[model samples]
Target: MADFIGPRLYACYNCRNRVALHDDIVSKHFVAGHRRRAFLFSHVMNLVVGPKMDRRFITGLYTVADVECSDCGEVLGWRYEKVHEESQKYKESKTVLEKFKIVKDNW
Candidate 1:
Protein backbone atom coordinates (compact mmCIF):
# COMPACT_ATOMS: atom_id res chain seq x y z
CA MET A 1 0.00 0.00 0.00
CA ALA A 2 1.07 3.54 -0.65
CA ASP A 3 2.41 5.36 2.38
CA PHE A 4 -0.09 8.20 2.28
CA ILE A 5 1.30 9.50 5.53
CA GLY A 6 4.75 9.57 4.02
CA PRO A 7 7.84 9.41 6.12
CA ARG A 8 8.42 13.06 5.32
CA LEU A 9 5.87 13.80 8.04
CA TYR A 10 6.17 10.55 9.94
CA ALA A 11 9.32 9.52 11.76
CA CYS A 12 9.76 5.75 11.88
CA TYR A 13 6.13 5.55 12.96
CA ASN A 14 7.66 4.92 16.33
CA CYS A 15 9.85 7.89 17.01
CA ARG A 16 8.32 11.31 17.52
CA ASN A 17 11.56 12.86 16.30
CA ARG A 18 12.07 13.51 12.59
CA VAL A 19 13.82 10.91 10.41
CA ALA A 20 14.22 10.01 6.76
CA LEU A 21 11.91 7.62 4.98
CA HIS A 22 14.49 5.05 3.85
CA ASP A 23 16.44 4.97 7.10
CA ASP A 24 15.84 1.30 7.57
CA ILE A 25 18.06 1.09 10.60
CA VAL A 26 15.99 3.62 12.52
CA SER A 27 12.67 2.46 11.20
CA LYS A 28 13.55 -1.14 11.85
CA HIS A 29 13.78 -0.40 15.53
CA PHE A 30 10.23 0.86 15.49
CA VAL A 31 8.94 -1.71 13.02
CA ALA A 32 10.30 -4.66 14.90
CA GLY A 33 8.18 -4.00 17.98
CA HIS A 34 5.40 -1.42 17.69
CA ARG A 35 4.51 -1.45 14.00
CA ARG A 36 1.91 -4.17 14.19
CA ARG A 37 0.17 -2.75 17.22
CA ALA A 38 0.05 0.73 15.79
CA PHE A 39 -1.25 -0.42 12.41
CA LEU A 40 -3.96 -2.49 14.02
CA PHE A 41 -5.21 0.44 16.06
CA SER A 42 -5.22 2.70 13.03
CA HIS A 43 -7.00 0.06 10.99
CA VAL A 44 -9.83 -0.13 13.47
CA MET A 45 -10.18 3.62 13.43
CA ASN A 46 -10.38 3.63 9.66
CA LEU A 47 -13.20 1.16 9.89
CA VAL A 48 -15.10 3.41 12.28
CA VAL A 49 -14.87 6.25 9.80
CA GLY A 50 -16.43 4.09 7.13
CA PRO A 51 -19.33 2.76 9.05
CA LYS A 52 -21.81 0.83 6.93
CA MET A 53 -24.94 1.25 9.00
CA ASP A 54 -24.84 4.77 10.37
CA ARG A 55 -24.40 8.31 9.22
CA ARG A 56 -22.27 10.40 11.52
CA PHE A 57 -20.92 13.88 11.89
CA ILE A 58 -17.60 14.77 10.31
CA THR A 59 -15.37 15.68 13.21
CA GLY A 60 -12.17 17.65 12.78
CA LEU A 61 -9.86 15.08 14.28
CA TYR A 62 -8.62 12.24 12.07
CA THR A 63 -6.20 9.37 12.39
CA VAL A 64 -3.58 10.30 9.82
CA ALA A 65 -1.56 7.29 10.82
CA ASP A 66 -0.26 5.41 13.81
CA VAL A 67 2.79 6.44 15.76
CA GLU A 68 4.85 4.75 18.44
CA CYS A 69 7.46 6.17 20.73
CA SER A 70 10.77 4.49 19.97
CA ASP A 71 11.78 5.04 23.56
CA CYS A 72 8.71 3.17 24.75
CA GLY A 73 6.11 0.77 23.35
CA GLU A 74 3.25 3.22 23.51
CA VAL A 75 0.51 3.35 20.89
CA LEU A 76 -0.31 6.93 20.08
CA GLY A 77 -3.24 8.34 18.12
CA TRP A 78 -5.88 6.55 16.08
CA ARG A 79 -9.12 7.11 14.15
CA TYR A 80 -9.87 10.73 14.85
CA GLU A 81 -12.60 12.76 13.17
CA LYS A 82 -12.14 16.09 11.50
CA VAL A 83 -14.86 18.67 11.72
CA HIS A 84 -16.31 19.72 8.36
CA GLU A 85 -19.76 20.27 6.98
CA GLU A 86 -20.61 17.54 4.50
CA SER A 87 -23.84 16.49 2.90
CA GLN A 88 -25.20 13.04 3.44
CA LYS A 89 -26.07 12.80 -0.25
CA TYR A 90 -22.84 11.00 -1.02
CA LYS A 91 -23.21 8.44 1.71
CA GLU A 92 -24.48 5.92 -0.80
CA SER A 93 -21.36 6.12 -2.95
CA LYS A 94 -19.25 3.01 -3.48
CA THR A 95 -16.09 4.35 -1.92
CA VAL A 96 -15.17 6.96 0.67
CA LEU A 97 -12.79 8.50 -1.86
CA GLU A 98 -15.72 9.26 -4.14
CA LYS A 99 -17.52 10.97 -1.30
CA PHE A 100 -14.43 12.90 -0.39
CA LYS A 101 -14.06 14.17 -3.93
CA ILE A 102 -17.64 15.26 -4.14
CA VAL A 103 -17.47 16.98 -0.77
CA LYS A 104 -14.16 18.63 -1.53
CA ASP A 105 -15.23 19.95 -4.92
CA ASN A 106 -18.67 20.85 -3.62
CA TRP A 107 -20.25 18.92 -6.50
Candidate 2:
Protein backbone atom coordinates (compact mmCIF):
# COMPACT_ATOMS: atom_id res chain seq x y z
CA MET A 1 0.00 0.00 0.00
CA ALA A 2 1.09 3.59 -0.65
CA ASP A 3 1.19 6.33 1.93
CA PHE A 4 -0.28 9.03 -0.33
CA ILE A 5 0.26 11.51 2.45
CA GLY A 6 1.04 15.22 2.30
CA PRO A 7 4.31 15.04 0.40
CA ARG A 8 3.83 11.57 -0.97
CA LEU A 9 1.25 12.47 -3.56
CA TYR A 10 2.33 14.62 -6.52
CA ALA A 11 0.79 15.67 -9.79
CA CYS A 12 1.57 18.08 -12.58
CA TYR A 13 0.70 21.66 -11.81
CA ASN A 14 -0.95 22.37 -15.14
CA CYS A 15 -2.37 18.95 -15.84
CA ARG A 16 -3.14 16.54 -13.04
CA ASN A 17 -0.85 13.95 -14.49
CA ARG A 18 0.25 11.73 -11.62
CA VAL A 19 4.00 11.78 -12.00
CA ALA A 20 4.81 9.74 -8.94
CA LEU A 21 3.29 7.94 -6.02
CA HIS A 22 4.80 7.34 -2.59
CA ASP A 23 7.22 4.78 -3.94
CA ASP A 24 8.82 7.03 -6.51
CA ILE A 25 10.10 9.82 -4.24
CA VAL A 26 13.77 9.27 -3.50
CA SER A 27 14.14 8.35 0.14
CA LYS A 28 15.98 10.84 2.42
CA HIS A 29 16.27 13.28 -0.50
CA PHE A 30 12.81 14.69 0.10
CA VAL A 31 12.87 18.36 -0.75
CA ALA A 32 16.68 18.57 -0.58
CA GLY A 33 19.59 19.44 -2.92
CA HIS A 34 19.29 22.34 -5.37
CA ARG A 35 15.81 23.40 -4.26
CA ARG A 36 13.73 22.67 -1.21
CA ARG A 37 11.35 20.49 -3.22
CA ALA A 38 10.59 16.82 -3.15
CA PHE A 39 13.39 15.11 -5.06
CA LEU A 40 11.89 12.07 -6.68
CA PHE A 41 12.82 9.85 -9.59
CA SER A 42 10.56 9.78 -12.60
CA HIS A 43 10.91 7.58 -15.61
CA VAL A 44 10.48 8.77 -19.21
CA MET A 45 7.02 7.22 -19.19
CA ASN A 46 5.86 9.45 -16.34
CA LEU A 47 6.75 12.79 -17.86
CA VAL A 48 4.81 14.51 -20.62
CA VAL A 49 7.72 16.39 -22.18
CA GLY A 50 11.21 14.94 -22.40
CA PRO A 51 14.43 16.66 -21.24
CA LYS A 52 16.09 19.25 -23.46
CA MET A 53 19.54 20.79 -23.15
CA ASP A 54 19.57 23.83 -20.92
CA ARG A 55 22.21 25.72 -18.97
CA ARG A 56 24.29 23.67 -16.59
CA PHE A 57 23.27 23.78 -12.95
CA ILE A 58 26.37 21.88 -11.88
CA THR A 59 28.80 22.84 -14.60
CA GLY A 60 30.40 19.89 -16.44
CA LEU A 61 28.22 17.51 -14.46
CA TYR A 62 24.67 17.93 -15.79
CA THR A 63 22.45 20.40 -17.61
CA VAL A 64 18.71 20.84 -17.23
CA ALA A 65 15.74 22.81 -18.45
CA ASP A 66 12.02 23.06 -17.92
CA VAL A 67 10.06 19.86 -18.17
CA GLU A 68 6.56 20.92 -19.04
CA CYS A 69 3.23 19.25 -19.30
CA SER A 70 2.02 18.18 -22.74
CA ASP A 71 -1.57 19.19 -22.06
CA CYS A 72 -0.76 22.56 -20.51
CA GLY A 73 2.56 24.33 -20.77
CA GLU A 74 3.36 24.54 -17.06
CA VAL A 75 6.84 24.15 -15.72
CA LEU A 76 7.01 20.94 -13.70
CA GLY A 77 10.45 20.63 -12.17
CA TRP A 78 13.48 19.94 -14.42
CA ARG A 79 15.20 17.13 -16.28
CA TYR A 80 18.95 16.56 -16.26
CA GLU A 81 21.66 14.13 -17.27
CA LYS A 82 25.40 13.68 -16.95
CA VAL A 83 27.61 15.25 -19.63
CA HIS A 84 30.98 13.55 -19.25
CA GLU A 85 31.56 10.00 -20.38
CA GLU A 86 31.60 8.23 -17.02
CA SER A 87 29.36 5.25 -17.60
CA GLN A 88 26.89 3.76 -20.03
CA LYS A 89 23.88 5.15 -18.13
CA TYR A 90 25.46 8.59 -17.83
CA LYS A 91 23.31 9.80 -20.72
CA GLU A 92 20.16 8.64 -18.96
CA SER A 93 18.07 11.35 -17.35
CA LYS A 94 18.06 11.93 -13.62
CA THR A 95 15.21 14.33 -12.84
CA VAL A 96 14.58 16.10 -9.57
CA LEU A 97 10.87 16.17 -8.83
CA GLU A 98 9.71 19.66 -7.99
CA LYS A 99 7.25 22.47 -8.82
CA PHE A 100 4.40 19.98 -8.83
CA LYS A 101 1.24 20.40 -6.85
CA ILE A 102 0.49 17.82 -4.24
CA VAL A 103 -2.62 15.75 -4.83
CA LYS A 104 -4.83 16.97 -2.01
CA ASP A 105 -7.63 14.47 -2.40
CA ASN A 106 -7.41 10.72 -2.74
CA TRP A 107 -4.20 9.71 -4.44
Candidate 3:
Protein backbone atom coordinates (compact mmCIF):
# COMPACT_ATOMS: atom_id res chain seq x y z
CA MET A 1 0.00 0.00 0.00
CA ALA A 2 2.91 2.29 0.63
CA ASP A 3 5.25 3.14 -2.17
CA PHE A 4 8.87 2.96 -1.04
CA ILE A 5 10.56 4.25 -4.12
CA GLY A 6 13.74 5.92 -5.17
CA PRO A 7 14.72 9.34 -3.82
CA ARG A 8 12.36 9.93 -0.93
CA LEU A 9 10.50 13.19 -0.47
CA TYR A 10 11.55 13.12 3.16
CA ALA A 11 14.56 11.44 4.71
CA CYS A 12 15.31 10.74 8.37
CA TYR A 13 18.99 11.14 9.09
CA ASN A 14 19.78 8.93 12.04
CA CYS A 15 23.27 10.40 12.33
CA ARG A 16 21.84 13.75 13.35
CA ASN A 17 18.67 12.32 14.86
CA ARG A 18 16.59 14.71 12.80
CA VAL A 19 14.67 14.76 9.58
CA ALA A 20 16.31 16.19 6.48
CA LEU A 21 14.71 18.09 3.63
CA HIS A 22 15.14 16.90 0.08
CA ASP A 23 16.28 19.21 -2.67
CA ASP A 24 12.84 19.37 -4.27
CA ILE A 25 11.24 20.01 -0.93
CA VAL A 26 13.89 22.55 0.02
CA SER A 27 13.29 24.43 -3.18
CA LYS A 28 9.59 24.63 -2.45
CA HIS A 29 10.07 25.50 1.20
CA PHE A 30 12.73 28.18 0.73
CA VAL A 31 12.13 29.16 -2.91
CA ALA A 32 15.91 29.34 -3.43
CA GLY A 33 17.00 25.65 -3.29
CA HIS A 34 18.88 25.89 -0.06
CA ARG A 35 20.06 22.56 1.36
CA ARG A 36 17.93 21.31 4.20
CA ARG A 37 19.57 20.97 7.56
CA ALA A 38 18.84 18.82 10.64
CA PHE A 39 19.86 15.26 9.93
CA LEU A 40 19.30 12.10 11.93
CA PHE A 41 22.35 10.20 13.24
CA SER A 42 21.78 7.26 10.91
CA HIS A 43 22.34 9.29 7.77
CA VAL A 44 25.54 10.86 8.98
CA MET A 45 27.41 7.58 9.06
CA ASN A 46 25.82 6.35 5.86
CA LEU A 47 27.29 9.30 4.04
CA VAL A 48 30.65 9.09 5.72
CA VAL A 49 31.10 5.38 6.44
CA GLY A 50 30.19 3.89 3.09
CA PRO A 51 29.25 0.17 2.72
CA LYS A 52 32.11 -0.94 4.93
CA MET A 53 30.20 0.28 7.97
CA ASP A 54 27.35 -2.24 7.50
CA ARG A 55 24.88 0.45 8.63
CA ARG A 56 24.92 -0.88 12.19
CA PHE A 57 26.43 2.31 13.51
CA ILE A 58 23.03 3.65 14.38
CA THR A 59 20.72 0.82 15.25
CA GLY A 60 17.69 0.39 17.48
CA LEU A 61 16.39 3.78 16.42
CA TYR A 62 13.04 4.57 14.88
CA THR A 63 12.07 7.48 12.69
CA VAL A 64 8.77 9.14 11.97
CA ALA A 65 7.14 8.91 8.58
CA ASP A 66 8.19 11.25 5.81
CA VAL A 67 6.08 14.28 4.86
CA GLU A 68 5.76 15.95 1.48
CA CYS A 69 3.30 18.60 0.37
CA SER A 70 1.54 17.79 -2.89
CA ASP A 71 1.36 21.43 -3.91
CA CYS A 72 5.12 21.52 -3.51
CA GLY A 73 7.87 19.17 -2.34
CA GLU A 74 8.62 21.22 0.75
CA VAL A 75 9.61 19.23 3.79
CA LEU A 76 7.01 20.55 6.23
CA GLY A 77 8.86 19.16 9.18
CA TRP A 78 8.14 15.83 10.81
CA ARG A 79 4.49 14.75 10.69
CA TYR A 80 4.28 12.63 13.82
CA GLU A 81 0.59 13.39 14.16
CA LYS A 82 -0.27 12.43 10.63
CA VAL A 83 1.95 9.35 10.75
CA HIS A 84 0.48 8.14 14.02
CA GLU A 85 -3.08 8.72 12.87
CA GLU A 86 -2.56 6.90 9.63
CA SER A 87 -0.95 3.95 11.37
CA GLN A 88 -3.87 3.77 13.75
CA LYS A 89 -6.39 3.95 10.96
CA TYR A 90 -4.73 1.28 8.90
CA LYS A 91 -4.06 -1.02 11.84
CA GLU A 92 -7.56 -0.50 13.26
CA SER A 93 -6.07 0.28 16.64
CA LYS A 94 -5.89 3.29 18.95
CA THR A 95 -2.33 2.62 20.11
CA VAL A 96 -0.92 5.54 18.20
CA LEU A 97 -3.46 7.89 19.72
CA GLU A 98 -2.63 6.56 23.16
CA LYS A 99 1.06 7.18 22.58
CA PHE A 100 0.26 10.78 21.75
CA LYS A 101 -0.97 11.25 25.30
CA ILE A 102 2.52 11.31 26.80
CA VAL A 103 3.77 13.56 24.06
CA LYS A 104 0.83 15.89 24.62
CA ASP A 105 1.22 15.73 28.40
CA ASN A 106 4.81 16.89 28.15
CA TRP A 107 3.63 19.87 26.12
Candidate 4:
Protein backbone atom coordinates (compact mmCIF):
# COMPACT_ATOMS: atom_id res chain seq x y z
CA MET A 1 0.00 0.00 0.00
CA ALA A 2 1.08 3.51 -0.68
CA ASP A 3 0.60 6.56 1.50
CA PHE A 4 -1.49 9.42 0.25
CA ILE A 5 -0.77 13.11 0.50
CA GLY A 6 -2.61 16.16 -0.64
CA PRO A 7 -1.61 19.61 -1.76
CA ARG A 8 -0.63 21.97 1.05
CA LEU A 9 -2.98 24.89 1.47
CA TYR A 10 -3.58 27.99 3.53
CA ALA A 11 -7.08 28.60 4.81
CA CYS A 12 -8.84 31.52 6.39
CA TYR A 13 -8.44 31.49 10.15
CA ASN A 14 -12.04 32.44 10.73
CA CYS A 15 -13.70 30.06 8.28
CA ARG A 16 -11.12 27.49 7.27
CA ASN A 17 -11.84 28.30 3.66
CA ARG A 18 -8.89 27.40 1.53
CA VAL A 19 -7.53 30.56 0.02
CA ALA A 20 -4.13 29.76 -1.38
CA LEU A 21 -1.82 26.89 -2.21
CA HIS A 22 1.66 26.56 -0.80
CA ASP A 23 3.07 26.09 -4.25
CA ASP A 24 1.78 29.48 -5.28
CA ILE A 25 3.75 31.38 -2.68
CA VAL A 26 6.30 33.76 -4.15
CA SER A 27 7.79 34.91 -0.88
CA LYS A 28 7.27 34.21 2.80
CA HIS A 29 9.29 37.09 4.19
CA PHE A 30 6.83 39.89 3.50
CA VAL A 31 5.72 42.30 6.19
CA ALA A 32 2.23 43.72 6.27
CA GLY A 33 0.88 46.80 8.03
CA HIS A 34 1.25 47.04 11.80
CA ARG A 35 4.44 45.00 11.55
CA ARG A 36 2.61 41.80 10.86
CA ARG A 37 4.19 39.00 8.87
CA ALA A 38 2.63 37.98 5.56
CA PHE A 39 3.08 35.75 2.58
CA LEU A 40 3.08 36.76 -1.06
CA PHE A 41 1.30 34.36 -3.37
CA SER A 42 1.16 34.29 -7.13
CA HIS A 43 -2.38 32.90 -7.12
CA VAL A 44 -5.29 32.57 -4.73
CA MET A 45 -8.79 31.08 -4.71
CA ASN A 46 -12.10 31.47 -2.95
CA LEU A 47 -11.47 35.12 -2.16
CA VAL A 48 -13.49 38.27 -2.76
CA VAL A 49 -11.40 41.18 -4.00
CA GLY A 50 -12.66 44.46 -2.58
CA PRO A 51 -12.52 47.95 -4.12
CA LYS A 52 -9.25 49.08 -5.59
CA MET A 53 -7.46 52.00 -3.99
CA ASP A 54 -4.04 53.55 -3.78
CA ARG A 55 -2.09 52.69 -0.61
CA ARG A 56 1.39 53.76 0.35
CA PHE A 57 3.73 51.13 1.71
CA ILE A 58 7.38 51.01 2.68
CA THR A 59 8.30 49.82 -0.79
CA GLY A 60 6.24 52.42 -2.65
CA LEU A 61 2.73 53.45 -3.56
CA TYR A 62 0.48 50.81 -5.08
CA THR A 63 -3.05 50.30 -6.20
CA VAL A 64 -4.43 47.38 -4.22
CA ALA A 65 -7.63 45.69 -3.18
CA ASP A 66 -8.47 43.89 0.01
CA VAL A 67 -9.07 40.16 -0.33
CA GLU A 68 -11.61 38.54 1.93
CA CYS A 69 -12.72 35.00 2.39
CA SER A 70 -15.75 34.17 0.30
CA ASP A 71 -17.14 31.85 2.93
CA CYS A 72 -17.05 34.19 5.92
CA GLY A 73 -16.06 37.54 4.47
CA GLU A 74 -13.02 37.80 6.71
CA VAL A 75 -10.30 40.17 5.59
CA LEU A 76 -7.35 37.92 4.81
CA GLY A 77 -5.09 40.33 3.00
CA TRP A 78 -4.71 42.46 -0.09
CA ARG A 79 -4.01 41.89 -3.75
CA TYR A 80 -1.60 44.09 -5.60
CA GLU A 81 -3.55 45.55 -8.49
CA LYS A 82 -1.01 48.03 -9.76
CA VAL A 83 2.62 48.68 -8.93
CA HIS A 84 3.76 52.29 -9.20
CA GLU A 85 7.46 51.59 -8.96
CA GLU A 86 9.27 49.94 -11.82
CA SER A 87 11.48 48.07 -9.40
CA GLN A 88 8.43 46.65 -7.67
CA LYS A 89 6.57 45.74 -10.84
CA TYR A 90 6.89 42.03 -10.11
CA LYS A 91 4.41 42.35 -7.24
CA GLU A 92 1.54 43.32 -9.52
CA SER A 93 -1.31 40.84 -9.42
CA LYS A 94 0.18 39.12 -6.40
CA THR A 95 -1.78 38.45 -3.22
CA VAL A 96 -0.46 39.09 0.27
CA LEU A 97 -2.09 37.09 3.04
CA GLU A 98 -1.49 38.02 6.65
CA LYS A 99 0.11 35.18 8.60
CA PHE A 100 -2.21 35.56 11.55
CA LYS A 101 -5.26 35.44 9.30
CA ILE A 102 -4.52 32.04 7.78
CA VAL A 103 -4.00 28.51 8.97
CA LYS A 104 -2.15 25.69 7.31
CA ASP A 105 -4.08 22.81 5.80
CA ASN A 106 -3.15 19.37 4.48
CA TRP A 107 0.37 19.60 5.73
- The candidate scoring highest on lDDT is 4
By TM-score, rank the candidates, best first.
4, 2, 3, 1
Per-model TM-score, in order, reads: 0.18, 0.56, 0.19, 0.97
Clashes of 2: 1
List runs of model 3 lying over 4 Å from the truth: 1-60, 81-107
Off by over 4 Å in 4: none
TM-score winner among the candidates? 4
lDDT at residue 22 of model 2 (Cα atoms)? 57
TM-score of 2: 0.56
What's the distance in Å from true for residue 93, model 3? Answer: 11
Report the number of clashing residue pairs per model.
11, 1, 15, 0
Please, what are the lDDT tens digits per residue for candidate 4 over residues 1-107?
98899999999999899999999999999998899999999999999999999999999999999999999999999999999999999999999999999999999
Per-residue CA lDDT of candidate 3, range 21-52, in tens? 23222122111114333222112111111111
lDDT of 1 by residue, 28-92 (tens): 11111223322111111111222223223233222232223334434443222332335422212
The local distance difference test score of each candidate is 0.25, 0.53, 0.23, 0.97
RMSD in Å for all candidates: 16.2, 5.4, 17.6, 0.7
**Steric clash count of candidate 3:** 15
- Write down the worst ten-residue block by lDDT for model 2: 98-107
Model 1 is weakest, by summed lDDT over 10 consecutive residues, at: 98-107
